[model samples]
Target: MKMIRNVAVGISGGVDSAVTALLLKNKGFNVTGVFMKNWDIRDETGNCTVEKDYEDARWICDKLKIPLIQLDFVKEYWNEVFSDLLEKYQTGYTPNPDILCNKNIKFNKFFDVARNRFQADAIATGHYANTSFGPYLENFKENTNVHLLQAYDSNKDQTFFLNQIPQQTLRRCMFPLGNYLKNHVKTIAKEASLHKIAQKKESMGICFVGKREFQDFISEYIDDKPGEYVDLDSGLSIGKHNGIHKLTIGQRCRIGGCENAYYVFSKDQKTNTIIAVDSGIHPALYTDFLITQDVHWISEEPHELRHSGVLSCDFRFQHRNPLITCNVYKISDNRLFIRLSVPLRAITKGQYAVLYSGEECLGGSIISYPGPSFFALNQQNSIIETRCCDLIALTSGVQM
Candidate 1:
């Protein structure tokens, strides 16, 4: 008798995950659905959607005649993901908690539980990315040398988010929806009589927080400190902002009664001020070089970067522009300095700089700083000089 492989699927209460469980079940695997509860926070109206999602997950599992497992990672999420996110915001960096969540919680903790506790031979998800054993593994029966590839649906490819996941974890993972498009996945769900979930709108914003306003959600943890908004060109105060932490690079200013809409060009955390520009197309908003720390590679560091000293990169996920050809310089084993082929707009610090060669994701790092455009630096220098003069004058008057 052929032994059935036990596969655990992460049912996220969405059409994609529901379809994934269905596909795996049809393939003769002993399928189990797992729902992860990572956030317990409620919105301003005291509403929480976790129960609704759990209901949906249970409904899907019941329809499929499979068992459902619910696990709470709330404490783990707060400590590992939320804490790091708050610290990054305090330091004026926009960090991606989704990336960290996949690394620390989903792949690490969830993977461990499914394998050890549930005795699952493999774990699966609804992510739109492909994974396969690496070449030269035909002779080996043991799972080894896994490669994460771009999904068949380029529009929904999630390799960027999964770049930080380790190769070993990826080897034991499955993506049932990898080869299918989003519309096709919905079609499968509808055919399987999951019409309610098929038509359910996709969730957006942060992963765990669901649909809350970003500014309001962040303010709950970090206090709001009001600051001045200065025009970079004129070095004059234009408007007042609620707080520098509340804003991000390249965000539009809601400051009313302006002839032209202003965009956040830069931020000075020390001064608690934001610099604005009248036009989004300002040269000051773009940068050609960025320095990053804590870089991670999925399989191994690129051979070209080590041998030839250059590799192409995608600084941001789902970026519409062409891939950036860059020269990679190693600052340390875990840090890198990348020079881009073209200047990118709003290269925010604390964002991941994911690298790729062809269709393979090479992994990425958190951006420490974006090398500012010459025009932006000049404006900042002028402001610093004026502030120094003002301080000196104040000290001289005290002496007199």
Candidate 2:
């Protein structure tokens, strides 16, 4: 029934959160600024940007005349987010830390703190997505009917990064910046005399881990043993590598002494070998379907992507959210048989396979590929030789 009055807006010392706090304050909600100290403790070689971020958040809060609170979540960040990431990588799957951080920390931990600790009515953030809590809340004491909608600015939309969060958590969350474009937010910040935030560079990469080489950052937690780089087709050694963990699928750079253009398509931990394939001017790097595990459906009961025998999906986060039919039969209790309507290239593992229908994000899971991997089938390769689509369908089924 009634709209939320007291709100705790998570301020990250960035333009987006700054603008969100300003917008909420203007709307007459009792707003308090909180800077989440998720990764306060860093490794010996690593550093936490907490001091700088806290200072910036404090500065903005003073200017806006809102009470600022710093909540330290170092243990929770290590246990829930980073520890899970290390486990995923150890098992050879790529995991998006930001997604987990938002789900477990922002919506879950941060909301719990605001409700139980600070006694705030609701929690808000700078995420570029709108929220919808249905009118039938009187029937349910705890809200369980929230829907996440796309932001007005498609370019800055962060919905894909948030598909893993539970539906109920989406209820108590507010995204004030969702209705405005980045430029409009900048203008608002400037008019509000928050010009210091206007000139700040946008933060990139994982929030907990700063902008360093991924392998280098992870080495602190996980140790690696070096392996060999081999030609995928030939199985002949081309060069020695520091470790398989140092590389990833579809990577083309930093492997020593390749004759021509070569790309890493897969890695074999059993043989300690990195499979390198020939990637010409334009490599055939596409695929159809993905064997996925660890599914998280926000709204409805989880089901296989197939409804009428085809798996409908969105394989990547940015640009061209392709709508394709799919068929997902169960392979095990967890893993599923993902067969797409058409071929997709570079369907990377450890990447999110977010399924959608029109504007609704149904669910998402991790991407998986079979062994002895090669270039993904495409039209160009079909004219030269065997169609990738056919080869992929035939060979992938055999591997499965």
Clashing pairs in 1: none
Per-model lDDT: 0.83, 0.73
Number of clashes found in candidate 1: 0
- Summarize candidate 1's per-residue lDDT along 288-338 as a digit string, tens digits: 898999989898887767776556555553334456677678877888989
Model 1: residues >4 Å from true position, as ranges? Answer: 1-4, 134-143, 312-322, 377-400
Best by TM-score: 1
Clashes of each: 0, 13
Q: Where is the poorest 10-residue window by lDDT in model 2?
A: 133-142
Q: Write the per-residue lDDT of candidate 2 for residues 1-400, one digit (tens) a residue.
A: 6556888999999999998999888888899999999877654565668888899999999999999999988899889988898887776666788888988998899989998888887788898877554211212235556556677888887888888887766766778887789999999999999999988899888765676777787787778777787775576888877666666666774666676767767767787777777773334355555687787777863443334433444445333464566656656555666766666555667877776655556657776653222344433455656556567768788532
Global lDDT for candidate 1? Answer: 0.83
TM-score of each model, in listed order? 0.89, 0.83
